[model samples]
Target: MADTDDVINTGDLFQDPDGFYEPEKEPTFAEHRMRSGDTVRGDLLWNAGRTSAHYIEERAAELIQGKDVLEIGAAAGVPSVVSAIKGARVTVMTDYPDPDLVDNMRFNAGLSAAMIPANSTLHVDGYKWGNSVEPLLAYLPPNSAGFDVLIMADVVYSHREHPNLIKTMQQTLKKTREAVALVIFTPYEPWLLPKTEKFFPLAEENGFQVTKMFEKLMDAVLFENDQGDEKLRRTVFGYEIRWAEDQLK
Candidate 1:
């Protein structure tokens, strides 16, 4: 037998490991074309987000220009950036506090820096829904009531978070009748459309009024092979939520 010192430490070399290590995944991104002719990239650019940005530029320019605007669940912050370009007084873009997600949002914001107007300021923050709005509120001008507009894009798919979404809206939306929260989403899972639709009624119960704005059909479904009604998946639904008449008082 060989001496112990000469023995190689190759014990269990032939044995299969209990688990295999996977290499860290490199992040992937999708490119989006803004109405201003600039291109932005994100992990994935949901059609609802693109549509919301378009709506802001075309239909809601009056609401965004020179107003305090906040975007929750802002994946790439396209709408917030567009709002800044449109001359919003303050545009705050927020998403869950994941390093990768937040960093990507900041990157996109930086890319569009030159396009943003001198009078408008754009900020980025990591925020979770239903959390304290104070941090977000801090970005507003001194003595300001609250944001004039809130952008919610492609967020209602999570059926469980409806209440939390509404809570954030209540906390941050200004009480004035002109203040509005834009909730836009696509029913990716067609079967769950009813659950997604429940958000509007719940918002009404929470002292808000919901108005259906428009239904847009995109050129293609975001996920072509997704198991759902192709038409529903390609369609983007938009709504405006405002303080109920009583709440505005």
Candidate 2:
């Protein structure tokens, strides 16, 4: 419920003069894009941000075109923007639903509207993991099946939210064979990887099939002072999740 001004201050807390972490200069995602007049939100940059954007533009461009896409925990919503620009049938960018977060997403969407295809529609909504899907479902085309693709990047850091995240995916993703949820994450707390990896098994037990897509290591660390394992912090994991064949019944 915090206002946009409060969120701007929240973003400022990430910046430290001692160089412990490199915080993007812009205060918020919307402000950065509007000022730069760029489709990408460089101020809210993450290693996964660039990787996922590239994959969508270079590798998944064809697959994403004309597909219903939903992105969760999309702070900057860069990947979703990329998918929309690449021609998704419809794209919805959602996050914690805070007034500021949701409004910022809308601001970003508004500025990037021209890049989206005329036939493609982009929406912004406030959504919480494991919450009711009814509101989100209402946004889908009246006769549509379900979202064709789900995008989650750098969202697995919170160990407690894994189950809720999976549940949201289950309720929103299409059961079709080709529909998938792209779960990409980096273990900022490298030593906690084993705990983070538990999400895959949890997903399988909940009627989803998980496939490992790739492991990418970043060239730089987001936090220089955190004593977490370097390799784990820098390595990013990409997984493809789909409804288990039997679960469709």
Candidate 3:
């Protein structure tokens, strides 16, 4: 964790759970280390349960090369920065309203941008779920239909936010380009399947066809049964959805 002095040159520097500097305290999410690339400098909340999973990142960059991109639920901007670093025309890092991640994302974006050539532009931003695209519209041309690429990761943690996530994806995806939303989840309860279906159906209604691109295993240790014997049946899976152009029909 980078301190208020912006200089934590010693070992075992921790941000107290209440705050980064609340007199003497402890680091909440195990040990602290300054990471490289776009900085996305927030606290343990965003860092917790966060990973730059290969399946998600590889698919996102696969969709984003030579394209304009928007990454929703971009907790720490890892995918967004990767797209920018890969030469996407532009990449916007967006997430739910949280001051800590927002500032951290900006710092991270700056860190990434500094290393890039002079001709590229990669932007970082904050967005509220279920809102109109007014702020996001500034980047895309009017009636452009959709962005060249749209990506998300680990955003399927809830059943309620699924519809809103679909709506946001529809609003941001172009009619021609393959709009990809990668949701990797560890099924805590079976309820997620029905809720996921509810949200996924909206893609076709919004004039796009969706497909399951791929699936891979992930470590799932969060949800345990009453017995608490490491919950043998649960596993995390990654999904890639390719949203096709409505007009192609």
Write down the TM-score of every candidate: 0.86, 0.82, 0.66
Candidate 2 lDDT over 1-249, as tens digits, reads: 112122112233223356443343342222223222454554455666666766777755556998999999887788888888778988888999799888877876776778777888888999988788888888788988789999998777666677678778877898899899988887776666776787788778777899999999888766676577898778878988998898777
Compose the digit string of candidate 1's lDDT tens values, residues 1-249: 112123222244323344432232243367767666776665546787788888898854678888999999998888888888888999999999999889988989998899887999999999998777899999999999999999999888765667678878888899899999999998877887886897888788778889998899889877666776999989999999998998755
Clashes of 2: 0
Name the best candidate (by lDDT).
1
**Model 3 Cα displacement at 217 (Å)?**
2.0
Candidate 2: C-alpha RMSD after superposition: 9.0
Candidate 3 Cα misplacement greater than 4 A, ranges: 1-53, 56-62, 141-144, 188-194, 219-235, 244-249
Candidate 2 global lDDT = 0.75
lDDT-best of 1 and 2: 1
Off by more than 4 A, model 2: 1-39
Which residue pairs show backbone clashes in model 2? none
> How does model 3 score by TM-score?
0.66
